[model samples]
Target: MESTSCEKNNVVDALTAVEMLAALEQYRAELSEKDRVIADLRSRLEILEGVNHELQLQLGRFHDVLKPLTVQLTHNLQLSAGRHEQYALPTGGARLKRLAISAEPVDVGLQHTPAKKVPKNDV
Candidate 1:
């Protein structure tokens, strides 16, 4: 008769089993936490996308309303300037530049962001 060996039996040690269970529980907890964070980020992204769409709509409306005024202003400026050199002429001690400055607060309907400074010699 052939002798049977019991050493090859699949068995887990007590300490190793406990460690595996603990590791599995820890992994589950980490996964749950990651899932929650991902959900929050997705929600925030949706809100930001909505805000961006609204801003684009507002910008389109702004351009629509300002088109005529902008055309008229350009015509007047061209007439007064006569040539490119006269465009830099000072008015009331201030040069013709962007109205908003970096230090000024711009209203975005939700919060205020600092306006970017328009560099000199840039249109």
Candidate 2:
């Protein structure tokens, strides 16, 4: 009987060990799945960061291109205004001189004559 009891206890211990090992394997599998999910998320974040950096670089390039154009446009406007003033000054002076010359008075004498009018109803 004693040997039989010892054998039964051994069998129970072996079975319990197998059950514990199976539970540990399940927990390990869950942990591995979580690690894989975290890795995928990290990869996606890295891609997004790269894209954002590229966009910022492109924006800077656009600003660089626009800056020269704005400066050129301002320079052209100033040059055009200077030319307009240079050309207009002589014409304005000439116009003023002509106006002064033409404004001199010219006089003409009027001759007076008396005229008689007949009434339409009498005619």
Highest-scoring model, TM-score: 1
Tell me the lDDT of candidate 1.
0.72
Best by lDDT: 2
Tens-place lDDT per residue, model 1, 1-123, is 122333323243556778999999999999999999999999999999999999999998898788667666765778788745434544333445644466434556525554569988896
lDDT of each: 0.72, 0.74
In terms of TM-score, how similar is model 2 to the real structure? 0.47
Candidate 2 structure quality by residue, lDDT tens digits, 25-107:
99999999999999999999999999999999999999778866765575578687874323332221133123235433344
Q: Which stretches of candidate 2 lie over 4 Å from their true place?
A: 65-123
Model 1 residue runs over 4 Å out of place are: 1-12, 81-123
Q: List the residue pairs that clash in candidate 1.
A: none
